[model samples]
Target: MAITQIYLNLPVSDLEVSKKVYTAMGGTINPDFTGDTSAQVVFADAIVVQLMTRETFATFTKRSTSDGPIEVISALAAGSREEVDRLADAALAAGGTEPREAQDIGWLYNRAVDDPDGHSWELLAYHPAGGQG
Candidate 1:
């Protein structure tokens, strides 16, 4: 069969704060999940994540952890440049912090932010050379 959906499981220090910030950025919280230990916040049909508390996650993974910067570049592609800008603004307004300004990378434009829990997210707009404006 084919892979139908995906969920990015991220570690967070505080689930409530993280949920608020993500909701501010336009994600919806799924109510079907039973407990506060984890939440499924949906960004798109195929894009959602189970934001888990550090203690809960550590126990599940059978490992210990420390608070630190994200080691990888996690990204979300926006529907348009305006959408990218809107998300950046909303994220900041929701207590998320921008790590840097948006940049034009010739074919793509992007900006990055650190969520309240320190998970990194890059919002981007891509324009193929021959595509419509």
Candidate 2:
């Protein structure tokens, strides 16, 4: 199946601060979808993340927010290992937390970072050099 677009909604305590963190990590804010309670953060052409305030998000679901445990780890493919490191570093410098160092396993490299709101994001790159496919 070919998907046109994907939007991941996240509940944040501070909308503007979340937008800033995402933008610092190379994501773009879509002013058309941004408002006082929510902001659309676009990472790629088809990937858009909606950052909504806790109060605003509650309108969509009845479940309480899960900001403590590891709810999810959103991973995106990078152009190269350098790009992975760069984006991860940017997130860390902009108030995001790096849970661990970059992992390189011959054909794949990955790094994880948690945004200020405790949203985990893993940046990864695949190198086909030592692969047996």
Q: Which candidate number would show the highest TM-score if scored against the true structure? A: 2
- Number of the top lDDT candidate: 2
lDDT of 1 by residue, 1-133 (tens): 9998878888788898888778766789988962679888998999898888987778768655587655777788887878888988988888899988788766788888789877888888887883421
RMSD of each: 2.0, 2.5
Candidate 2: 10-residue stretch with minimal lDDT: 124-133
Runs in model 1 deviating more than 4 A are 130-133
Superposition TM-score, candidate 2 onto the true structure? 0.89
Clashes of each: 0, 0
